[model samples]
Target chain A: MLCVVNTSAEELRRIALQHFARIGFAGASLNAIAEEAGLSKSSVLYHYSSKEALLAAAVEPAVDRLAEVIEGFTRTGRGAMDDEFVQRFVDLLLSHRLEVHVFINQGQSLADIPAIQRANALIQRLGDAVTDHIPTVRDRIRFGVALGGAAYVLVAAAQWSSEPLDDLDETRAALVDTITTLLADLPVSSAATA
Target chain B: MLCVVNTSAEELRRIALQHFARIGFAGASLNAIAEEAGLSKSSVLYHYSSKEALLAAAVEPAVDRLAEVIEGFTRTGRGAMDDEFVQRFVDLLLSHRLEVHVFINQGQSLADIPAIQRANALIQRLGDAVTDHIPTVRDRIRFGVALGGAAYVLVAAAQWSSEPLDDLDETRAALVDTITTLLADLPVSSAATA
Candidate 1:
């Protein structure tokens, strides 16, 4: 029903992300990736020339998904700002904080690798997209800070596993509520909300 | 003159931490440490017999400083539960963010080594001390989240050498304000008035 690249390329990317996340980039070898994907080594090489290339491709879905979520929040022409979408985004990040840890932790220097550097743009765009939708300077600041703060707390909890952060989730919810209230109060247009 | 630690053991510890931070624990060479410290290889050996011993000593100061800071805040007793102390603690971390980064960055795994791992208990004691000072659950929760968020951001910012966080001091202040506001509202007794 779909194109060939759509199916196999997507499948390979998924497999590669899973394996690299668990074992780390250096620990992840071509053979291991191939085995994880149930493919021959040669087949992987056919798709991506090097480990760097494979790693770059693997993060694409995550980048795209985040971009979509952020962009959906900021789509002012079509919709005012969707609190539900924002909540889901925050929830996704909190519940699967490990995915983010695996993404950033494995090596922040991945930006030096030519193909892998694109995620930087994706991250910036996500921030910009959300920041753009908010009308008031205070609201914009609140939105960015809340998002960043929540994300950071989740990572800290993961890193300081022994330290309890049951309260952090409550703080996170309160932060989101604050942002939502700020957005709702903004004197945007009727059509955008309607 | 100040009573500096003249013992061979203390001197070696001081010198090794400098080298380990500049290079990394794995990357630091024992011979180079001896050269910089103005001690012969034999003397360095007399103080710390192995490279691992030297490296463990190297990461200790930053971690020790962190414990010290945590302890200082905790020792303030019920005063630390106040918004002003929380704000000051946040300020302290931001001002010294760079030193914290050097200790935590690659040096975190130093905790795996038996000698340095004991230092983790000191750090945990500090965290425990934080809760012991708080009078209520809500203030305790607020303290944890704010401190956690501030620590995470300030450390990561050290990686970006070009950022003008050097001038505005915005990053640290922003974190403190976030924590202060969250705590102020969450608890009945405590108020974080920025």
Candidate 2:
């Protein structure tokens, strides 16, 4: 077959992700995104209605991808909500820190848009599914708390990361460790003992 | 002592924080802030140098105060860093989740300002001084990561507290548990032990 370089949607998406990362959602006008994507603005608009719609399409898949990562933990065993899974969840969350930031910051601004809302709703359902998989009643509650803690570690990681802790790698490793330990030592055991 | 129900400074700050919280830094207008604060537009300028300056003054204290709270842990346990001190550190951080939200959300918008820079430098110095007291080298390295994780928990706690986590009290308890556990199980403990 004769060569072709720009017709596929895959190439267009890759171009969009790079531009979006460099210029932020609001700053990256659709004109720029279309130019970067090697497609006519009309062609871009033909597939996605507006700049908001394009931004939503570009990022929401990553959200679904993360939710897919979390959903994998559901098969992690009877204590699907156990310490190991929770800790793994923390790693997954922090590893995708920039993506999480994109979602939290720009996602809300476009949240009322139908596609974005549906994507986030799917993310929520994944969380609920994870919680539902845990067998122990009290452990379920503790897991929920641990889940909350994991989310915090993510958002706060940047500011405190600059502190005099080890280098970035070591610091991230420590963060993961801290969350795992927290899950293992959840007060559930003590509550059961009491 | 005489007490006043409303003062110009207090009113302006209240208005500024609300507006900053609602629309973010680039989006909030000084005139809007003045209107919300119930002061003459000139009065806001009289109290603060510029819009960015006013925003910094309003937000930096919350960050400074957060650092002070974490710094309080040094005062506990024979004036040294210890497990009890870490627990109290977690408590201090979790207690002020909203302030954490304001600081993190507005931080980037105000990132380049002198006041915000000074405040962050102070917080970093405070963190360094605390880490200086630790005997175990690995523990010191991991401390920042652990702390970063704790900060993230506060942000996540705020989001969840809006609905599923219910009121702040329950959220606080949940956060305390998560952080305490994370501190206890730091991964570098293995290195510290070995």
Candidate 3:
């Protein structure tokens, strides 16, 4: 019985995440999500008390993972410029493509929701972690472009591609390479040759 | 007399763009836009028959500018990898930061709106122009990251920053440099050193 309830809840979250990513959270309907999951609206509510609750459930794991990543950065005194951190960040993004899509694009409009607010705060902290060690606004914006850009590219790729990305390994390698290039601190003369 | 009408219309668009960028089109209210612009709701309607029309007016110039950029690419055979094209693209994004923000983050949710649909189509054309010459999926995703990432970073910077970005010249130079690096097709060995 516990297994049955857990499976249903998981199924509902999958459907809900898709809806939230496709349409903004405000535009998604609880009824449509329940119907898609082959359950009554009341049954959907039985598992998650409200639409906000459902959104929280659907996105929290990704949010928590990001939080953990930030915690790791803080603990180790490592930042986004670190190659291992970049790799881990890219992996996290690819794994949670839909949740990141919802958070990046739709999270702003839904900031009144406590879940989204928390996610936004986490993103700010992540930004701080990335930029705190860097001095110039130029370098700061580079980190922003590299990290934010990686998230944007992954989400856009997932959203716009008709078929799933054919090669995840290739995508990951290309992303890491591009981000490393973006974040590298090279002298202007060397950059020209580079 | 013509200038007076034009000034009011421009003012309304300015206010509408901010609202759309900040809260998104679905969450933004026409009434609030009118009030902010110090005009009556009827006057706002007189200029733009519907909320969609207002959105169209607000974003069309930026969309048109991007379309021109893509057309230049097609006409000149200068894809996103070209240095001049990168500079021009970065300039357009910085000048119209808020419009890009609305188009990127909220455009997906408001696809039913004709204006957003047009903007989204332009972005697809821009993508095609960037990647048509590049053979690999990896290169394609690289272009997506560089271009989309630049736009996302700029918008996020604008949205999240408490004060306006202090130096446009530095921002533009850094963006052009970062994008050039992202799009550069360096050999694997040189890339390691670069």
Candidate 4:
């Protein structure tokens, strides 16, 4: 019974992504989504209930996939995640830039929504995965900072860059290099007094 | 004439900060601010006009202070920014946690406001202050990433920490270490090719 509903929801999610990308979260109304999907307004409402709900449905899969990737790192028993892993994570963020854009733009006001809360939890989990390997509190904080920094760049690269980012591959490589350097340098243990 | 206006405006901005910190940017109302400040609604409107306008007044001083700090770095002609400067920066950010929270939480959506736009431009300039000595594009990107990461942690620390962040000093040290590592690890020209 749920499988039948899942199919339609999946279809709606795909359509929602396109509408969101083109018109943004604010501009993409349920009526527009329904019109674009060739579905009745009531049908769309039945599945999504609201615009925020629709956005959550559209963004959840990507968040789930990201969680799985971070989970893999946690299970691997590595002391630190490599640049390749960081690069892969950046790629995921870049691929879902539209959704990321909306989630970030919504900020603290909409954080009470279940989907956004879950996504925030997942992000915390990802941050934990990167920092868990470091034994010292100081290094852990530093790792957290580096991770936060790399993620910020990936999420807001388009806005931060002076020139338009023409080559994403090069951008990815540069970001990986930055994260790699941050992870490689370990502070002296005695100096980490806190 | 402007002197008398500035005094009352300053008082209103101070009252607004307390309201904004307690209730958040979205939750803070102009009426609430006026009531809290012992001013009439019309008086508050005469001074600030809108909530965003009130926010602009409140956040501008902190931005100006930060700009001064960054300007010092730019004039120093140092190869790399020292830990003291970074610590001062971290302290400035931590002290203005409420304003930082509002600015970051607004994200890309409110960036078009003249105050927010000026703030963003100032942040870009700060990134430049640290990286201007470095010639390569990869190093510059890495520098930007570290700066963004440090800034994000500073802004979001209150929310992101699982427990209330009891020790800000430790957090500041850790962030400084992360940024220092990023600056120190400038790529060899050959290694920077991406």
Candidate 5:
């Protein structure tokens, strides 16, 4: 019985995540999520107390993982541009593509939500970790482009494409490679120096 | 008299854009906009027939500029990776930073709005223009990362920073340089090949 109840809650979370990701949190309907999960509205509420609660449940894991990634950066102080760090970051992003989508795109508008606030705070910490070692404004922006760019592209690919990214492995490897390249200490451009 | 009317309309657009960029279209209220502009709601309506119309007016110039940029790409078939093209693209993003923020972040939620639909379509055309020459998914994602990444960073910088980006010239130069480097045909990684 406990196992069945857990499964139902898990199923509701999956359905809710898809809805939250496709539509903004403000736009997604709790009733619709309940209906999609083949449960009554009250039952949905039983599992997650409020719409915000459901949102918190759906996005919390991703937020926690991101926090962990940031913690790793804090510990090492050298992992921001490391290959393993980039790979881990890319994998985390791909794994939580939908949650990351919500965090990136809707974060500002949904700032009042506690889950989103925590997620946003973690993102600020992550930015600091990545940019702390970088000296110049140009270089900091480069890392910003690389990290924020990777997040946006993955979210966009998921949103824009009619089909699932069939070449997931290829896309993942490419993302890691591209981000690492952008973060690498390449020669300063003449235009930038000028 | 004509100049005064035009200025009032222009002022409304400017105020409306800041609100829309900050809170989002659905969240921004016409009454508040009118209050900010020291005009009545009816007077605000006189300038724009509806909220959607106001949104249309606010975003149309940026859309037209992007359309022209894509047209340039289509015309030359060789401008996507060009330095001049990248510069123009970066400038468009910075000059209309708020509008780009709305278009990038709130676009999915506001897709029912005609203005947003038009903007989203133009983005698709722009994506096609940039990626048409690239064969591999990796290369295509690279272009996505560079272009989409740049857009995301600029929008984020504007939103996150308490003060305006003081070194606009340096930031712009770095963006152009980084994007050009990403779009340039560099050697592929072994991981990408595998």
Candidate 6:
């Protein structure tokens, strides 16, 4: 008898992430993912017990990376945290757009999953780290807006723009500067600077 | 022969919006909406040709109100545009949370619908209107962040908060102030004023 391993679990996860992002957690099917991975359904099930397991594996890396980013910020001092954090957070999110897409698409359905829960906690911590420096009620709200805007823009950039986001660095720099301004206590005049 | 018209189309739409927001577009069935509205499925179909039509009818008011808000802002001068625009926009969104929920949940699936397309164009126009005064790329992106943040916070507040959003007015005031801060061009120091 000849034995053959159809597809590795890692490859399944990679393909699953793409499917999840393109469709959604409920929309993505194990058979389609197996076919995309060039593996039989039985072989795919052998690696992961169910679709939920596959989703957990697929989203784990992105969640871990985000947790790491938050952890890295926590180790650093309060000064320049917002600048450094925004730069790193934007970079991470832009590079991992697919991951972010999949995670968001899952929405509330997969909220109870360990990976999703962990990511949420980490994100809450991350939000605190960002908003902690801003003393005023308004600035804190603005901080939330800054974070949401960055995420929304990075994710929806393709839909919003006719062409590729060529000015990514400029966008990142602008996002960092904007967040920094939001973090500050005083409001400056545009006419005064001009 | 007896004729009965138990539920109004407007009431059906109100209930439909709630269902669509709670579940989703595909997840929301006409039968379910009919049941919720205490109308027969045939009656629901009589009022609206299909589920898509019903969904469109439900979201149209919010979209139209948004259009009016943007138009109102255009008539005003540049100086008060940001403040007035943010105030009206925030108020509109906070009140019409269900409409926003249904629109967001549908995502790309209903993008091609005329109502959806019109809403998208109006939103694009809205973005342009808000960002028109900000000359730089960064501020423009910040403008987007402010808008996205406001939408996200309002929608996700129920899930993220343990209690009701009782401090909504304070939050609204803060968001307006934050956008005003982002709209400003100069980097005002935190210590300069204090």
The global C-alpha lDDT for each of the candidates, from Candidate 1 onward, is 0.56, 0.54, 0.77, 0.65, 0.80, 0.68
What would the per-residue lDDT of candidate 4 be over residues B24-96, giving only the tens digit for each residue?
A: 5655677878887788889998988787888888888777777776776666656326665666766776677
**Best candidate according to lDDT:** 5
Model 1 residue A38 CA deviation in Å = 14
lDDT of candidate 4 over A10-44, digit per residue (tens): 78888887665433455457887888788888899
DockQ of each: 0.17, 0.21, 0.51, 0.35, 0.51, 0.43
lDDT per residue for candidate 5 within B111-130, as digits (tens), equals 88887888888888766765
Off by over 4 Å in 2: A1-49, A70-78, A82-91, A105-109, A126-177, A185-194, B1-12, B29-49, B70-79, B83-95, B105-109, B126-146, B160-174, B185-194
* TM-score attained by model 1: 0.60
Candidate 6: residue pairs that collide: A149-B145
* Candidate 5, A3-66: lDDT as tens digits: 7459989999989998887766766788899999998999999999899899989999999998
Which candidate would rank higher by DockQ, 1 or 4?
4
Please, what are the lDDT tens digits per residue for candidate 3 over residues A64-159?
888877777666764334667677888899899889878887666778887778889988876776566666777777777877888888777665
| Model 2 Cα lDDT, one tens digit per residue, A109-157 | 4467665566556556654664555444334445544444445444444
lDDT score for candidate 1 against the true structure: 0.56
Candidate 3's C-alpha runs over 4 A off are A2-5, A78-80, A186-194, B1-4, B38-42, B78-80, B186-194
Native contact fraction (fnat) of model 1: 0.07
Sort by lDDT, top down from the best: 5, 3, 6, 4, 1, 2
Cα error of candidate 6 at position A46, Å: 7.5
lDDT of 6 by residue, B76-158 (tens): 53544445666788888778877875555455556878887777777776666655656667766776776676776666564
| Reference-based TM-score of each model | 0.60, 0.64, 0.87, 0.71, 0.88, 0.75
Better structure of 4 and 5 per DockQ:
5
Ranking by DockQ: 5, 3, 6, 4, 2, 1
Q: In the order shown, what is each candidate's alpha-carbon RMSD? A: 7.6, 6.7, 4.2, 6.8, 5.0, 6.3
- Count clashing residue pairs in model 1: 1
TM-score of B-chain for each predicted structure, in order = 0.55, 0.62, 0.86, 0.66, 0.87, 0.77
Candidate 4: residue pairs that collide: A149-B149
